[model samples]
Target: TDFEKEIKGDMLSSFISEVRELVLDNCKSNDGKIEGLTAEFVNLEFLSLINVGLISVSNLPKLPKLKKLELSDNRICGGLDMLAEKLPNLTHLNLSGNKLKDISTLEPLKKLECLKSLDLFNCEVTNLNDYRESVFKLLPQLTYLDGYDREDREAPDSDAEVDGVDEEEEDEGE
Candidate 1:
């Protein structure tokens, strides 16, 4: 199918069968439905489909190894339960700039045990009174909401930490 070919063309490697990360940003989805994907992408760990006009995730394939998913800037309104079922191991999910409005719309995310970091920036839900508290209560499994935890502590950036370590090592060698 054309969808499969598009995914293949975007793959980092020529071998699409063993893709671990795929970015299809700005590509149009079939009316918010993803088709032509298969279990052959079993090794896929990270996927970014930003601005794809997705309205639902019901058609997403089961990706056991998936840890991070970027669906920011889409039209997804609800039905996150499909993510818990399809991307069971997902730890980080970026739904920033979507149409999520009420807290109840996020209730289904409780089923995702591995989910830790969730970003809902620019969503309507962020405007609710006590939004942070409500979301933390709803999804107890989430360690960080919009990059901060219940205590308002920011999540550590791995890349920055690695760079800091490198700088310290260079200083020690001086």
Candidate 2:
């Protein structure tokens, strides 16, 4: 209901004129397809379409100024390649809980040098072997994945004993 009203160019143009953030969570676009809506928000820096039942990203309009986009909990199966090509300035993206299953689907994201944070939690691709390493290699610019940062993923094991603690002294202290 709200999404339909928002997608109307005249209405959206008037609404967008006053804000840089567009939140359309839980509002399905026409026919579960995402088209013609994004072009209206040319100046938007943040856009959220969470749980909108989007089936594809093929028709996503070029958003030159958009830095953060949230498409979590949708039905998107693929199209990240087109997304990277279109939104070269994007820095943060959330595709969690979608139907994405292949890590190769993310290959095009390597072109997004500005992308720093990506969330793919609950997607089938997370189950793949070496998933974290693969994603890290694919998007070297990413400092955060899901909710974890680079240091969190790369931190050394914490089970190693301290160098200077003697067994006898440790036992005595206890």
Question: In candidate 2, residue 89 scores what lDDT?
Answer: 89
Prediction 1 TM-score vs. true: 0.81
Worst 10 residues of 1 by lDDT: 158-167
Q: Which stretches of candidate 1 lie over 4 Å from their true place?
A: 1-14, 158-174
* lDDT (tens digit, per residue) of candidate 2 on 69-167: 899998888877788777888888889999989989888888888887788989999999988888988888887787666557431222332232332
Residue 17 deviation, candidate 2, in Å? 4.4
Q: Tens digits of per-residue lDDT for model 1 on 67-101?
A: 88999999999988898888998888999999999
Best by lDDT: 1
